[model samples]
Target: MKILLANPRGFCAGVNMAIQCLEECVRMFGDNIHVYHEIVHNKYVVERFTKLGVRFVDEVSDVPEGAILVYSAHGVSPAIRQQARDRKLQTIDATCPLVTKVHMEAIRYARQGYNIVLIGHEGHDEVVGTMGEAPESITLVDTPEDVEKLSFAPDAKLAYLTQTTLSVEEAGRLIAKLKERYPQIESPPKEDICYATTNRQHAVAQLTERADVVLVLGSQNSSNSQRLKEIAKSLGRPAYLIDGAGEIQEDWFTEDNNVLITAGASAPEVVVQEVVNYLKTTFNAELEEVVTREEHVTFPLPKELRQLQLSN
Candidate 1:
């Protein structure tokens, strides 16, 4: 069996900055820190921070007053930010700059009087926060079916924005459908989809076309990881979105089959190495990186963290 790994598959700059912010906070504040959510949605990364005494909480109310509270890389609504301030919690925003850009677009569109269609999974943290930006004006759509069901007033102007980590091809198809339905709909002036997502998906596209089986490394909640599996399956290849090597099934490796290994943005590189090493040692499979894109994007530490780092 052959193992094809995708370059630029794991840990985008936003995830890097968020994790680093937590690490630095742990170093600066010692064992007393709280994060608003999973720092970047990967279990391994969350578990690592938890082990270092970074307590994770879902609501700002759950966090004690005067505690240093860090927002996840997914970003949050304006209300959450205000809530943090009301509690006097030291706020460290680890929002991916790309996600922040989308938030700005949502606010701008709402201010411009256009009913917005946010293309993303409904319950996703990013979507939930974005929808909150202009709750009354923004409607959610997760699939082509949702597109067909759209019933905005004929006189209502429309614009669309997407969750940052969505499948590029799927979003493109949905956007095409929307344009056909509403020829005058205004799209986001810029692509809200992050470069990391597009690059990783492009890499997976190259791999899935050549491999018989595709294994995407990511948490179940990881949007981009799920999309990688979708891209592979859409091409008529069997695929699995496993968190790590332990989830790999022995029956998946056919005698002469090729397997492609790729990871989500939030996934750790070590996990990919573990999976690749396991495959090679167990099945004597050879591994090669399918180079599709080179990612050099690096988001800085959260604004607060940068200040704190500068002080000491």
Candidate 2:
């Protein structure tokens, strides 16, 4: 069996920065670290941090007053920040700069009196945080069908923002629909989808063409991971999204099949290697790597963590 592994498949710069921030928090403050949400969307990462005594809370109220609370890479709404402030939490923001850029765009559009249409999945942490920036002014739409149901005057000012982790193809289709519906609609100054997401999806798109089956390693809740699976399945290939090698189904594999393996931006390379090792041992698979793009982007650790390092 031949295994096609995708380069640029895992651990984007933002995820790296968030994970490092949490690690530094653990080292500096030990068990006192509390994160607002899953640092990224990988289960293994959250579990590892939990094992290290870091608390993950969906609500700010769950965190003890005045505790050291770190925002997740998904970023939080202003209200959540205010809540933390009210509780006197020592906040360390690990929000990805790309995500932050979307937030700023949302705020900017809202301030300009343009009704913002946020293109993202409902109830997603990133979407929720972004909508919270200007709830009254922002509308969430995941599909072209949702756009049809939107109620806005023909002459109303409008702007669109997108989730950073969205599939490039899916978002493009949605944007096309939006533009068709509102000829004068405004787009973000730049693409809101992060470069990491685009690169990983592009890598998967290139590899899936030659493979009989595709395996994407990431948590179910991970948006980018889900997009990768969708991209493969959309191409009529049988695709599976697994958190790790243990979730891999032997039934899906055959001696004659060529399998493609890729991982989400937040998924660790170690997990990808685990899947590769299992395939190699179980099927004697010959690995062929397909490099779609080279990525060198990096985000700095949170300012609070950097100052702590400097003080030491």
Candidate 3:
């Protein structure tokens, strides 16, 4: 057996920044810090933090009036922000800059009096926050079929934006359909999908070509992770999305199978290593690291944290 590991698979810059923000909060303010949601979607990461006494709340009211609250990388609606302020909570915004760009575009197009067609899965944290920017103007579409369901006239003043974590190919299909139906529709100045998501998907697509079976390391709810699995499965390869080593099944592979292993952007390197080690010990697999892209991206800590650091 052989193992093909993807290089740009786990912990993108945004996830790194968010995790650091939470860790810094824990160190500075102690374990009593409250996060608006799971800092990232990975189950292991949230469980680990929960053990450290960090509280992940679904509602701002769950937090104490004066407690420190950290926004997840997935961002939040303005109403959520207002609620935090109303509670007198000290807040740190850890939203990914890429996601923020989409929010900005939504605001811009809405102010310009355009009906916005947002390309993203409905109810996703990122999508919810983005639509909240201009709820009256924005309509969420998950697929080309959703585009057909749109009731806007062809000549309607329209603009489009996307959720940052969507599958590139899926988003492309929706955009093409939107254009077919509304030839005059405008697009954002930049693409909404983040670099990390595109690069990781590209890497997995490349690996799947040479791999007989693919193993994607990510939680069930991770959008980018699910996209990786879908891409592999779309190419007619057997793919599995697992959280860690224990979830791997012996029946899924044989000595002749070439396995491609990758993790989602929110997944940790330690979990990837654990999976790699398990495969090696079980199949005596020859491991090969495949690099599809080089990433040097780094996001600075939240301003509040930086200011606190300077003061200390």
Candidate 4:
């Protein structure tokens, strides 16, 4: 068997910042950390933190008063931030900078009298939080079907925004439809799909082209990772989302299969190593790395943690 490891597969700047924030929070404040949601929608990351005493909650009401509460990197609605303030919880905002950009655009466009249209999956954590930014002005559209159903005053000033992680092709198709319907509508100055997500998806797509089977290393709920898997599956290639090496079903690999391996933005590289090691032992696989993208993005750690490190 031959194994292909994709470049730029896991751990984007946002996920890196989020994980660092949690580590810093634990070190500075001790393990009584309360995160608003799964830090990055990856079960492995969350489970590892849980073992270290990090508390994960879906609602602000469940958080203990005066505890250190964190918003996930996926970002949160303004309402959520207000709720944390009302509860008197010590708060840390770990929202990804890119997601924050989209939220800001929603606010700016709404205030400028433009009706807002957001392209993202409804109910997604990021979408839900972003929607909260201009709830009265924004309408969510996920598909071409939704675009077709869109009905608004022809003369209404309008603008569009997008979720940070989305299928580029799908979003393009929708944008084209929107343009056709409202030739005068305004679009975001830039696409909201982050560079990391786009680069990783492109890498996964490239690797899957020559690979007999593609394996995506990501949590089930990771939007970027799931999109990578779908990109492969959409091409009629076999794909799977494995939490780790232990979840790799042997049945998916035949004796001569060439496997392509890619990790989601939230997945850790250590898991990829484990998967490769497992395949090496079981099938005597030879490894070849395919580089589609290189990433050097980094976000600074929270100030409180940085100060502690300096003091230490």
Specify the highest-lDDT model's number.
2
* lDDT for each residue of candidate 2 in 177-277, tens digit (9 for 90 to 100): 98888989999889999999999999888888899999999999999999999999999999999999999889998987899999999999889999999
Give the per-residue lDDT of model 4 (tens digit) for 1-312. 999899988899999999998988888777889999898988889999999999999999999888889899999998998999898988888889999899999999989999998999988999999999989999999989998988887777889898998988878888899888888889888889999999988997777878999989998888888899999999889999989999988999987999999988999999999999999999999999988867888988766556657877
Report RMSD (Å) for each prediction in the order shown: 1.2, 0.9, 0.7, 1.5
The sequence of per-residue lDDT tens digits that candidate 1 reaches over residues 1-312 is 888888878999988888888888998999889988788888888888888888999989999999899889898998899999999998889889999999999999999999999999988999988988989999999899999999987656999999999999889989999888888899887899989999988888877888999998899988888998899999999999988899989898885789988899999998999999999888999878878887778887877788888899
Model 3 C-alpha lDDT per residue in residues 1-312, reported as the tens digit of each score: 999999899999999999999998989988989999889999999999999999999999999999999999999999999999999999999999888889899999999999999998888899999989999999989977789999997689999998888899999999999998999999998898999999999999888989999999999999999999999999999999999998988999998889999999999999999989998899999999999999999999989889989998
Model 3 segments beyond 4 Å from truth?
none
Query: Any idea what lDDT model 4 has?
Result: 0.89
| Model 4, total clashes | 0
Error of 2 at 310 (Å): 2.3
TM-score, candidate 4, is 0.96
In model 2, which runs have C-alpha deviations exceeding 4 angstroms? none
lDDT rank order: 2, 3, 4, 1
Better of 1 and 3 by TM-score: 3
As for candidate 4, its clashing pairs are none
Candidate 1 residues lying further than 4 Å off, grouped into runs, are: none
